[model samples]
Target: MAERRPRREPRGLGWDGREFEVTVGPVAHGGHCVARHEGRVVFVRHSLPGERVVVRVTEDRHPGFCRADAVEVLEASPARVERPCPFSGPGKCGGCDWQHVDVAEQHRLKADVVREQLVRLGRLDAADPVVAGLVVEELPGGALRWRSRARFAVDRDGAPGLRRHRSHDVVVLPDCPITVEPAARAVLGRDWSGAGAVDVAVDSAGVVTTTRLDRRGRPTATRVLRPGADVPEEPAGRAERRAGGRDWEVEGTGFWQVHPAAADALVAAVGEFAQVRPGETVLDLYAGAGLFGGALAPAVGAEGRVVCVEADPGACAAADANLADLPQAEVWQGEVDAEGLGELLAELGSGPDVVVLDPPRAGAGRDVSRLLAGTGARAVVYVACDPASLGRDVAAFAEGGYRLAGVRGFDAFPMTQHVECVALLVSTAR
Candidate 1:
């Protein structure tokens, strides 16, 4: 109890602009490669693994770690390629992450990220076949022009552009290479003097719809233009989409896959994993437009039951319409949290044979995953966009006695760090 030491103040302004040379380590989650500098971890963007580069610390708020950009490359990996988009670079448009990487290598890198997340966060064994043999399949469309739906931020002066990395500043662009030409043109081709942002989408029929939102993020105007038409046409109520051998109607710029080919690829993977039999009950949680429920309805037959639960009313309505022809399929609009899911399971009065969930980027949280696993469903098919979220949820499922069966990844969002994963978890008792 001798003399008390004076309180130490927190350090401020770390190596924010410090520059250093480092050998980049393996890629980590969130579109960055790991590197070390003086015992501090540096998350360097615009850099590939196993390369020597000079990194400029862009952010240094944390004491243990910092964020940087590879301003100069001393040694480049073979996977490095000339960045195709002029708007993309270390401090430019933050839309695409792997534009400088070769297309094939981009797929491989995504696969590596998926496996690493599962092993590191999910606590799965690295030697597990599902983790060891993972691969990111390339969609039909190449990396460019795959983005069919995008939101462009509008600056105060009314210029529309994508946001810079972790920044609110909009980088005005003539066109976004990753986005479909028509969709990009609809948003970037014109200026919205008063809008804060614009949402644009090109449907399967090539109808371009743009919705202008004010600074508060409220929709101010909506316009629809048919293909090859310069003038605005009557509002195209719901954009039409085709997936799983049928046409679907979704709200303009709604929750359909940004990549045109993603739906088909995901449907095939889900169907193959689900293998729903006749007279079985299936739950499609977070169902958007009843894509999976409607697709499985035919396989389940009239005796079987398919329930699609979604929180968004608009999406639920679209799901209802999409599944209208299939009497066996029904859409329920509600939250998919632990509490809501429990109520849903109780109302069903019977355990589902298979549970399919395509949660948002945040993934189905641990509570929801545990509750779903407790339902004793034979199979749980998880469609995840974020690897960290998937890993956390998978770990929660494991606690509920589910084992990792298999997983497949899709390069749905090429040129970007985002990768879509479809994983199958089966009960150990099964």
Candidate 2:
């Protein structure tokens, strides 16, 4: 029998503009391709695998893979499209990368990314089942209300905008399409004579809230929670309830997904997947401002318990006050890890039956997943911003006993590659 031959490596090239036939590597969340040049791994933008291309290295790294910006397209994939958004030009003022690709094809790329990450990094056990995004658009009801919270940097010329896709330079977007005109109006319309940062959020009800130092020089809590919506009885509750909006006040600009409806769908899906009973104890990992725990409290009825673990100080404070009315919920202020979870579980005196993990785009740490796997929890609902990381955590949970029970997609951001996903994993033994 002939011995197995070593796999040929990808052709690696330096900043040379030379052309090469390169297989399009897996598409990453941000629209970069993980390609092999010779043998080393390099991240290239605007370059798809299978179609050979000559690319220019915008960022050069020695001893480490460099980042390249595709300068020439020798071959193009059928999935590629002429990007419609003018903001996505080569200057890179826009944030989205898959705009040049068809919407359905974009989803296929995302699904592929999720699968590859789960297999290679997360150790996922996915096969024929396909994971795709929800049909829901970013702006449902014909209202662009998804961008609930945004921080527009105040430019030197008084223009409010986002930084260029890859550069620190700001783009003067007098009006942003992702946000409603009114919500964006306040940002673009506001006079930034003396302000350094302008924070804005818009509710689904078309109500806009602006938080920042007023021209009067005082910190303000502006809320557009709507006229009929019930305000939380407590002031702290007000922060949590209104925080999930276009202008949802972030705790000092920490990490958060921008889509309100998408987040709601994610949380609602998580609640359903976990199958929270009337008295089951649930652990909310990376619980920012008690959004999931607080929302789950009512869904689980009076007998349930939701222990929220959050590392952000500001978010935890809001979470504590938000769940103040719900005696069944508690916000544990700490990092998410095995030790922290163990101590929290010990305090409960009983293990949780439902687990909801909503980590950052980076996903959850393996230790916490391992610990949760060993517990009495029979099901886990993992919510993720980066499917790459989500797949990784899914693999970890699979190792612990949880099986990929169900998967759903949500279009939190339309006209962009970014989307949200929730995975339901149930214990195999149970």
Candidate 3:
């Protein structure tokens, strides 16, 4: 006999599916606007600030706050516009949060979120010049078709698409407007009946590569398509990317910036803030493909040293290969944890003069932040994809005597709530 499936217990007094009118308030982190109905707070998506909309509660697991989508707009903000992507909207594709917002307004909203997160979580004063003067700069590409790399979820029937908002259900799509046309077509145009998802990327050379992953999220196969080629060629072990005035070798579908221009912009920002001088030592933690280390190696010169640390062996190998010509730069494969970082620092014999860390979305934890700050590095340039994570880590660094000196925001992921930030922190003791 077949095993019986467990039944889900209903949530009592829940607001799920309940509809109510709300006046949207300020933009909040995580791609939503805050609004209050009665005494409960609602995080409404697909709506702009200062707009009156009828929101449908999609989730109400928490007693104090619930997640909602604005189903009907009674009064629209000037920033509201027709969504460029037909796949976007309430209960539709959850990939983009600001599709309904104007492109310029989208940048402002992201800047607001970054500032708010820093002030609230980093314990920074709102009046601080760095916090008050923050702005989200736009990338070269327009709002649409800027995603150089993307992952499309494959449903059981084999259609590839993105997941719905906070849901496991896949919304099948013919194309994703925000994704590069070549990438979107490469994955969505094909049916992966057995694969759980497909990751596709278009490199700077116009080469398209697709990786098929099983339901367990393990890579099953990888195929490459050169420009103007009808069929995919044998799997190319690495993809070529040009950034920071150099070419980089990265694993296909690796952690390169989704925005084509993001790497160069970040490199410039990091370099300006780090201001590494000759004979200085620099540490690039979570260094993928040695992008920052290799870029800064010339500035440090042969008398200086640059160490690129990464946890992933694949990325480490790529970094090593990328920096082989730069004698001043070396790639060290290790986790950037508190304990590991401590050991690495001890082996260096001297603290780094400049530290550039491009941590993942979760950011370097408090322990890592404190450990890095203890190094007495003159400058710590942090590249963060999540503002809240950056804010929390900044707070931790403060405890170790570092002060946030400067910060710049980038709209690397347009049409989405995600924003990339480059921050500079200097030792207060200096």
Off by over 4 Å in 2: 1-26, 34-42, 47-54, 62-65, 71-82, 125-145, 154-158, 189-197, 210-257, 313-325
Tens digits of lDDT, candidate 1, 281-356: 9999999899999999998998999999999999999998999999999999999998899999999999999999
Off by over 4 Å in 3: 1-12
Tens-digit lDDT string for candidate 3 (1-430): 9999998654525888999999999999999999998888899999999999999999987778889999999999999999999999999999999999999999999999999999999999999999999999999989999999998999999999999999999999999999999999898857899999999999999999999999999999999999999999889779999999999999988989999999999999999999999999999999999999999999999999999999999999999999999999999999999899999999999999999999999999999999999999999999999999999999999999999999999999999999999999999999
| Candidate 2 lDDT score at position 360 | 81
What are the lDDT figures for the candidates, one per model?
0.93, 0.66, 0.95
Name the top lDDT candidate.
3
Q: What is the number of residue pairs that collide in model 1?
A: 0
Candidate 3 weakest ten by summed lDDT: 7-16
Answer with 1 or 2, whichever has the higher lDDT. Answer: 1
Candidate 1 deviant stretches above 4 angstroms: 1-13
Q: How far is 134's C-alpha from truth in model 3 (Å)?
A: 0.4
lDDT of 1: 0.93
